[model samples]
Target chain A: MGTIENILIIGGGGMVGQKLAHALAREPLTPGTTSALTLMDLGFPPGSPAGARQITADVSDPAPLRAALAERPAVIFHFAAIVSGQAEADFDLGWAVNHMAFWHFLEAVRQEHLASGGSYCPRVVFTSSIAVFGGPYPEVIDDGFPPAPLTSYGAQKAACELMLADFSRKGFLDGIAIRLPTICVRPGKPNKAASGFFSGIIREPLNGQEAVLPVGTDVRHWHASPASAVGFLRHAARLDTAPLGQRRALNLPGVSCTVEEQIEALRAVAGNDVVALIKPQPDPVIESIVAGWPRNFAPERALALGFRADADFRAIIESYIREDLAPEQAQRLRLR
Target chain B: MGTIENILIIGGGGMVGQKLAHALAREPLTPGTTSALTLMDLGFPPGSPAGARQITADVSDPAPLRAALAERPAVIFHFAAIVSGQAEADFDLGWAVNHMAFWHFLEAVRQEHLASGGSYCPRVVFTSSIAVFGGPYPEVIDDGFPPAPLTSYGAQKAACELMLADFSRKGFLDGIAIRLPTICVRPGKPNKAASGFFSGIIREPLNGQEAVLPVGTDVRHWHASPASAVGFLRHAARLDTAPLGQRRALNLPGVSCTVEEQIEALRAVAGNDVVALIKPQPDPVIESIVAGWPRNFAPERALALGFRADADFRAIIESYIREDLAPEQAQRLRLR
Candidate 1:
């Protein structure tokens, strides 16, 4: 009876949030205590899984957090924020949603603990990004590298990371933040993030549409499938974090490959037809933004601590195909 | 009349603030346009410098900041924070003064810019500390090391550092945060900071009174004179921060030495009799706090950028004697 029973997903309408929700529903956390899920977002996601009491709430407001913590949920997955492009474009909204909301949520949790006479320390699994790193960096960035985020999105995430560590150290909450690599073959419509093209190029071509290749194919970057990303969240939720000490954020492991290598891997899986779908179009705006993004990371700590990703880009593509796309859609995709 | 007509020192009541105020008074910023100084704190410091218009108010409240910025100060020296020991003692005040207050201050500056048709970007020089580092083991921490602050004070500083970088990147201010080393042989009577012994042990013994050495003589740490600290602020106020790119904070250079090394330096400068006045009595509270403090840092950035410190521990002691001790006290210290 003493386990994670009441779970809350703050950004349950988002892609990662929905996946995390499904993963949790598939395998109940700690088996005995996890019985109910409270999924909250700006709006209820279409066709969410059963047993979750879905809530449409703007978490940027303190009310949602106040209500969510009133349930005294055993675990909280905080993944809400405007994306990178939006954050940089709209400064005040970025500060409100990305930084202020997150800080207030933590403070609310701390206040709840104080209200409880120092008893509650909920496990908080946060989704951080490689955006926390900016370039003119070493070829292989590591755990020790201080965050020098060049974008508003990266800066917001990095600031949150620091607060997470502090909140945990002070014993207000048990938190673990995983800095994710780019999620390739993302199953969604294209959005404004500079990294959106990494997925769009692959996702569009597979669906029999032409894809724009904005940066040069020689550009090297890091990637993981959506499945691997959800796996990291799951692992982070349950793993013993005392080994993490005061450094609360771990750089999740991923497959490092150039765009040429990615296209080659796609070719190996789907042959020449898929390769032909990509149109070479250099975009300086996207290219400049992507240029400052971190190329690769040596995520030794996350790797040693048992978090794993797709071994190669081929495996990543395969995982996407197996998880996404209908049988008819898949057959058509293979031939197109 | 054209360059920097007015300036603001946010923490002018503090030790470094007072020193920086005096330093500025000695040399006009931009040679002609620096005409006035607005010194603000919780209470006015004793005998503020000439031409400094004094203020007494809580900076955690936005009213003082609004009033301060009404002067349209061209240079803003942000050095007002609750010190480490006090921050740890009061959690809410720490977050409010050390983190939230600093954040609000930045936002206020940003708002002022937005109100000015997007042109006002004041030079913001923040006084950060090596307390941002908490150690397991790294004999020489360098520019690349991520902060893992073990104390609430350090955490607050680290978080503020991240925000400083973000604010500067977003073009809100031309911000530069320099992590100052522990100032050795501080002039004033001792306070409650864990680092107080670093100054007290030397200052008291030189004043012909026995000083308590709370930890082992082998405990190593970094040091700079109060003068050098003020010099860092002066230099940082005018340094070309464009070269810093996305990373806004720097590890200011300092002399690194052990307590035993300090004792040897004291002996060299003031002879064996002065060194003998240090009495060893371990205080676990201070010892444990000091244990987590960083021993050394390789600050290649500040050194290359023309910041400097006392040449050696002997020089640090001599500087303290020259600046801090009275003429009679100095003669008595030399004889003793």
Candidate 2:
């Protein structure tokens, strides 16, 4: 295993990317040793590490990315992607950033590795998603889902996975793609993601605001906490892929729960007053998107590898309260 | 159902394409009527119907194909493809012919239909193959089997299926892809296809010549007669895809049999003398290719739609002798 002396996090400005960077900064890397970290985004935000080098360059452009990659970092977390909802809306932009950008990066790494043969190849951990699944599914999906993606975004991701597999098979780069479930209680204001409402209802209520729940109380989905998502990425980066052999992509396991269960968890933590903040509103667009998504996935292979999920919805709510909210806000849930 | 008054056969000079052209010509179209045919290929073979037209052009170049498609024939049979073995061996050729060429054609058709306000959408019947399936399979594969294609050819075909589905969904064109089983008792000289030896062992032995069976006797595979394959394409073109609705691709059924069963059919047809002419020569290259293919597929969807395979191995051999060989050659099957 190569020492991850200097790791670079691409798309660092995004919520998940930023959280991952923060988590890594707090991690104690292999006792009695340390490594420099380089974080890149369109712009550097507050709370980033002191003296941490930051670069402003579009990850979609190959020239600038090649320059970033020139640092020859031991680990690269490629978290850059146009989200599913946005990708579906803008076909051209989605193709450029989501698909072509990934291909260009992989090709660059391949050419570099060929030119400079050595003992170490950079580890590339990519974030795939459960959006890759579509409707007409079994109650639980498995590794062999035919990738009959209903939307262009899912197709693009599936296409990227194929390219990554072929490139890895050609022995160019050590690539790992983790198909993350919908991240619950995302620590931010609401975004355009249709599924964002799933987190919105819970997050907004905790922030003392009312939020709309677009679907019925019966709608269920698979979810992972931001911490678990970051853990999934780091574990994927460090795991021995030899056992995985030919299969480089994985469907990371997650907690599956219904809307009713989520609301119950919210009440358990923040009391009935907080739970009352959620109002049911039906939107066909959001319902269609949610409907097509797999409610749960039995990721047999990923589970076998020991990746964990939120213990329960209550644990998930507690995580948001403990890890994200301020001390004063945490005290609101102290009784629980 | 629309009547196939004027039929256009693209890539007409190819093996399957030519065979299909002849079969259509030899069969009756509708009562007291015949199709006005147009054959398009890179190089048109010598043939002239006083009215039938021929166009010579490269499919990769959209100019000629677009000009030809301007006529808006009622039915289009697309049998054009670079075979799997050749495609896997050459990357550029594979992408250009198998992938890009079809995209250009689809775009052209989409533009035409959109311009005409859907008044002039021609039914497209494209031929696909069983090479789309890969290893790690169950004893009886089903329609739900994921397309984890092992070769670039399979990937291209899978990609085409996606494009076809998208185009059909958008109402740009009416399309149907028939994933054909490997045609057994293929009547011709040996070719480069890895699966060619499967047919070669039977076809050559029936002709009173020695043939090599490169794979072991236990190797099982799905097969259909050349006649059945033609019927599949024709039926697909005329079938009402309205019920197939949106899900435009169908996996045509095929008879599943082991190599030993195939040899037994040949013996049953031409007696011990012909069977004695067979030689066993294990080849790892062919073995590996055959191993990745799906030996059987439970095509309930296709069967429900009225597509049928050869009833048995004996019937497959009998059809080959009766339909492909001369009367004198058919009479030589003394055991029958």
Task: Name the candidate that leads on TM-score.
Answer: 1
lDDT of each residue in B118-221, candidate 1, tens digit only? 78999999988898888885889878887778888898898888888888988888999999999887888787677999998899988888999999999998
Best by lDDT: 1
Residue range A253-311, candidate 1, lDDT tens digits: 99989999989988988778888899989999989998888878899999999999998
**TM-score of each candidate structure, all chains considered together:** 0.96, 0.87
| Candidate 2 local lDDT, residue A204 | 86
Model 2 iRMS (Å) reads: 2.0
Q: What is the C-alpha lDDT of each candidate?
A: 0.87, 0.78
Candidate 2 residue lDDT tens string, B1-336: 434577788887665666677766766344455776788888855554445677888878788788878878778888777888888776557756986688678878877786788887888888877776677889988877876667767777876776677567656678898899888778777766788988888888788788998899999999999889888887887788888865677888999999999889888777888888889999898898888888988999999999988898889988888776766656776535
Candidate 1's DockQ is: 0.70
Error at A181, model 1, angstroms:
0.9
Clashing pairs in 2: none
Query: Which candidate should be chosen as best, given DockQ against the real structure?
Result: 1
Worst 10 residues of 2 chain B by lDDT: B44-53
